[model samples]
Target chain A: MNVLPRRQFIGQCCAAVGATGMMSALSALRATAAAASIPSGNNLPGTEADVASDYRALVCIFLNGGNDASNLIVPYDASGYAAYASARTALALPQSTLLPILPKTSDGRSFALHPSTGELKNLFEGGKLAILANVGTLVEPTTVAQYKAQSVKLPPQLFSHNDQQAQWQSSIPDQPFKTGWGGRMADLVNSLNTNSAVSMSMTLNGVNSFQVGNLISQLSVQPASASSPKGGPVAFARTTGGNNPNRYQTQKDLFTSPQSNLFSSAFGTLSSNAIGNSDALAAALAATGTIATSFPDTSLGNQLKSIAYLISAAGTLKLKRQVFFARIGGWDTHADQVEADVSLGAHAGLLQQVSQAMNAFYNATIELGCANQVTTFTASDFGRTFTSNGDGSDHGWGGHHLVLGGAVKGGDIYGRMPSPVVNGPDDTGLGRWIPTTSVDEYGATLARWFGVSDTNLPVAFPNIGRFAKPNLGFLG
Target chain B: MKPATIYLAVAAGFLLLLLVLRPDAGVATDPRSPRIAAPPAPPASAAPALAASPVASEERSPLADGLNAPAGTVDEDLRIVATLIEVFRSNFPRDGNPTGSNAEITAALTGRNRLRLALVPPDHPALNARGELCDRWGTPFFFHSESRVQTEIRSAGPDRKHWTEDDVVTKQ
Candidate 1:
């Protein structure tokens, strides 16, 4: 019984035309090409589309602004915690507020999450959360002295935003490139799609480096409250006045009339497209009902709601394989640690939202009878320093991340956590700890689980061979 | 005027406007060409010793061709160099366009450190020598500069101001 907002309804009309029209255009182009060529019968294979309607997917939640991983995964063991406590003088999380995690082997080695991650604890206990420790970008295995002396060939711009972002997404830090690991995966497997309405890749966040590819563009989804464009064709299509044999009359009138040049005839077409897509997606979403699973009420929570709604309408979309991108930021605490956490109230709340929403989403899949088919993971630019800069923390490397899904060998920590020692041999003079694990290893593992062949892995992540293990041993 | 005449006049006017805007569309194609011609020579105030700053000796300077580089090739090089410079601003969030994929690059090229290259002439030794430097960086160092000038990488030297005359690893 709830009606969409007036502004939203209009925006939906615009978005519909934009996305659906483009998709239809691309599909038509593809169809023409397909008809011209003989069927290999081996069309684009390996997408969620190729498999059973009940399949799993991987959702990557990237926390921008270099989340302070030092605080997220604290050293819980006696000697390790002491080393952490001493090095992180002002930046240490209190022992009381910590959520203790006891690893399988209690060789007295453990860690704790910040008090803000209560939902994360529940998920971890429920065997849904798996921690990935101390991962970062690396051209090759590098040492601190080598880093300072510049002896090793490293990622082009270390500690750089644009380059690192591209590097993280492309897995090629050295040059301008095409497509991300996920996009490449979709390229390999999108043949299984039933219809062309939904893209294999979906980004709740706007267009990002990770979701862009030479041939693939991420289907951008705005939050529920945000307006989506409308779809379909000309307004007043049913009614026609006078002799309509010639279209010149309307064209003449439009051209002669003075209007906002910025928002002109061309914009009208663009708006129409946007609205078209919004209407299609919205209409598709309405068939979805109160999901049994509950999502958090935060921004990410709302995003998850939309994701769930879309997933509920997956049959309508005719999608087989789907990849989604979403995240929560504000972890850049450089001023007040306590106040930063407070200010990052939305962010902390977002994490809970992610955990709850993901759980709900997973349940919805199970309800749809597709539990083992969906996977979710988290990533960031880099980890924050263990030591706080008085009020907050500074950017550092080798932070912890998490991956969750039914397919993941959940309830365990992967990768080695460095000893939190300031200016130690492992430390790069600053709090930046050398990463034992590379993003290549992490991405390769996910790609492999997503059905990427070992041969295609290097093509997806060129630098994956430089690492000791192509597989991170986390996914089955 | 008759309606047909009005329509004809409007259509003609619109066609003229389209033709006028045609050049404007091309303007978006290459933005660095103007900066390269004048070489906004970073105001003398910032790097006071820039004039006295050591220029590589003829033997050490690969780009002794003067100021000019090949035509469209120079512009291409400028685009790549501009991308590289913008990469530096990525780490400094305070001075960065911490948003999406392309916006960050645009923001980095806006202020004082915005990219520029000066083309001297085809025969300039600096321009000719720059060919070697361009090959080394995997692209031309500066657009329009006969002597290809460029910011040094770690191999050239850590100082961001310096440029290398030779690719040392290939020297042997």
Candidate 2:
């Protein structure tokens, strides 16, 4: 036989193997195509070498039920407080009880946080937290005039809960929902991970629309429990325990066996991959050591703690990029949202839980040496009305959210803060302020920081070009 | 002829002329006129005669005149009924589900339901003895709703019948 060059021989063997494993080979080829598509002099912040070696994560803490953000972040100045107090009426917090925070940049007005969010106040002062103001779902840049005249397109079902939730997650309000921004971002950067045992996208809570992607599937993992501090992968019932080796083997055979039916074959293949991936992730978590940071014991606290643990196991799993989702509910406070003591009530209690849990999670990241590598952000269905409907506020658009991580340019507020006046210039009516910032701009900022190039930003947020700011600059 | 005799003849001729042309002037029986009859006056017994307190009068004044008099164009009558329903909704925001039947909404407005504050006085002329809200024509108003929050109110107009072309409607 004619002797071929060693490199040529190896290349021929790979091409021959690629023909047999077309699906797996196609993923590798797509990754190569994605890298090749990046034009020279790209807007990505780091060099290609840094992009290949570094790891980053995004944690989305969805505050289920529309959060009454008017109470969460309040005005502290004399005139500003007067306006807020006049609009909110009975729902307003006492001026003296607020936890004061002075942002690095000011719009000639002062502000403060709720009394319950003392931990968050510390994070803000320490330059680890930034506030994003007046952000919400928008079909396009809309003005109060445009809204009243019905000249500009608006997101469908403005105040209803489920529609707004999906709009916030998908970030493509103009189109029918197919994938979430987080899901699309993961699909774009999935090539960064050379040896990920589990999917790059993970949710501590159950499956969510935020992590639904076409190429990559989100792995739903349990929160950290007292028994298992680092939460383990969701396993098959048979694999959990019992001296039934025959049952486990039989289940395995059912998944591995060939099926002539198309549906059955697809099911078998999906089930087999799930089982195999779960086993691999479990093994990886078991081998990795735990971190020393302490976490709170609440539900949200447990979820964040589990995320911190997963971040710790990133090395063992060989993941370069990760995205996480967690959620907390009971924010729909239409009635009895506050007691006679405005500073203390259902809303304040929820804020306290969020502040404490986030503080603990941030400390955990610091201990794991990935404080700058991990960014956690908050989202909600919409903001509550500035004007109270008797005891509580109603659903409104454009709320404030919090962003926290070492990489954040913290101790500052980003986005235009709406004037807290009912039927003011920004108000569409009844204190529902038209959003100054779109969700597309907000998600694109985080996506850019997470290694997505400027050219591919629209793949994640299709409407980012419609908004003035693609990157909100909250992240460094 | 003499002057007195001539004057008397002219007056007689003018009188005859007036009599002959009066039938052609179309005063009461003009076919081209719209001919909207005035709403029937409510019965005297239907009006409430109570010592009015300041609070009760303030709450009752807006609907009191419209309910007691009940004489207006169809659009005006529809406006009164729509305003009544709007006031009811504002006071009891939790009670979003207003029934489509005229008697049911009339009962709720008259303080017969929970939170009995009597948004509309029971003795108001707009309500019949059966406690159903009535149009200017003394016919019960028809209510239709597709959503709990929005209700359409229809007045029977001068014909005093439902589902006719002469009905006036408004939504609240």
Candidate 3:
């Protein structure tokens, strides 16, 4: 399928451009050819092999460092804020500075968000964002008494960063895991995609734990280079488009050469996939017109913009379902959480970027008429300790999360925030909370909506059976 | 898009291809393997003074030893807590009888020519305990009597959380 356009394109470029752009095109073609020759079969059993008209995608915005969710979603009620401030002391945000929000259920418990999340608040009010509260990794439904008694099973290395991050992505806190919940889900639904060569898992962040599965390794796209032709998002071996036909032909011959060496052949396959996906995706994005909505000129903003571009080209990519992963670090605010103004600081800046990028990306989806089909959620290494260490907070367990989409049941809070009282049942000393809702239940909810059947929910997330509700009802 | 840029990209890819396709490259060797080392275990004996521990001398500010200390946030904090401990130690003699309440010492840290309004991090260790005197990590310096006379001042140190290997202290 790829043999003709690749060779013909190189020939045309060489002829028309007088050797200019021919070499890059030739090498690119060779890479794509290898990429298209993927060793298939990570598909789920009983697949219909039917292309689906309805498209849905899940975008996971992973905050690399442990985010202080306590400060993210705050309480505005007098008694609640008093308790929260008393527990957190100097770490608590000023009550007046908070952006107050009206939740769907007016049960008298008033809530507010970090002031930087103004755009997110707008999204919530506009019925496009839902808050998932007090969610964390859990092996089973656990209680305070059971947690204290050492009676119930707990996630391995409870407070450690690496362990908890794996638990969140893998949904298997008890032991070592290979396949992430995203990759597993992609394997199941990928059969719906017409382009069998392109995997469903994609990440802007180089390699990540969440997008690796037995059947689905991420189609890891390089960040679009400013110098690249048409903001090239593909990671090519070298710059593309030049007058060096001899060098191009040599490189192309080497990449396209039939190999007998096992290791060489394997490397060829990987390079092939990378080059192929890059060629296909880059061309599609270049062909696509400019987006109307403006994305902030930040790293996260650019990544989200790239994701928006890809989602808009869904038909070109022949995608029925896709799982996207992106990361924005510097969330580990162990010190200097805020500034002298109290409203601005490291955490606030990150949150602001998140709000702006998410809002813009949401609008882009609408621009593509795929707004209802895409849902984006935020994840972190873990939540910070509820109580401040003085300047900032340390790592903690349970934290609130945000899920946004047109299809989501917004303006509501799912799960419950444990009492802010340090060592008050919810706290294990310095305010490290035991999670109320497990990651299993959370992933199952998203997976179910992504087209995984009720029976196949456990296949996507192994520990879903331990929790009561498979569907959290956020993605309505 | 330009002639020169495309050449550069192809050249970059060529260099990359050469690197990955190195003849001596080892098979199945991944440099990104996770290194999961266990944290050092907590000390078994809960000695109040913590004097027997090694850090008693290393963490002391030059001011505590009557020498001009280097200026740094951590050193300044250690000096602050050490100053408070010295002040509190003078109030309570070695006889194990309490001379002043925890509040008096906290108020003393607030007064002039002493520890100024040096705000600690929000959830400092002493946030739950009495005194508000905090260390560099914004964690409260752990100040309590072994009995009533000897005072122990501890900072959660770099980790910012108490009771870890990274903890620093005044007077061991």
A123-212 per-residue lDDT for model 1 (tens digits): 677776788888888778777776654456666444444456566777775555455777677666566665655466666765566755
Weakest 10 consecutive residues of candidate 3 chain B by summed lDDT: B50-59
lDDT of each: 0.54, 0.72, 0.64
Tens-digit lDDT string for candidate 1 (B77-119): 3333333332323323223321211212222222212222111
DockQ of 2: 0.02
CA deviation > 4 Å runs, candidate 2: A1-53, A239-243, A260-262, B1-172
- DockQ in order: 0.02, 0.02, 0.03
Q: Which sequence of candidate numbers ranks them by TM-score, best first? A: 3, 2, 1
A57: Cα error in model 3, Å: 0.5
- TM-score winner among the candidates? 3
Tens digits of per-residue lDDT for model 3 on A211-286? 6555555655544435531243443433145445576456656665778997777555544544555566566555
Local accuracy of candidate 3 as per-residue lDDT tens digits, B45-112: 21111111111111111222211223556644555455444432332222121112233234333321
The parts of candidate 1 lying over 4 Å away from their true place are: A1-54, A105-108, A226-278, A339-357, B1-172
Write down the TM-score for model 1.
Answer: 0.61
After the best TM-score superposition of candidate 1, give how far the Cα of residue A27 lies from its true spot, in angstroms: 8.3
By TM-score, the better pick of 2 and 3 is 3
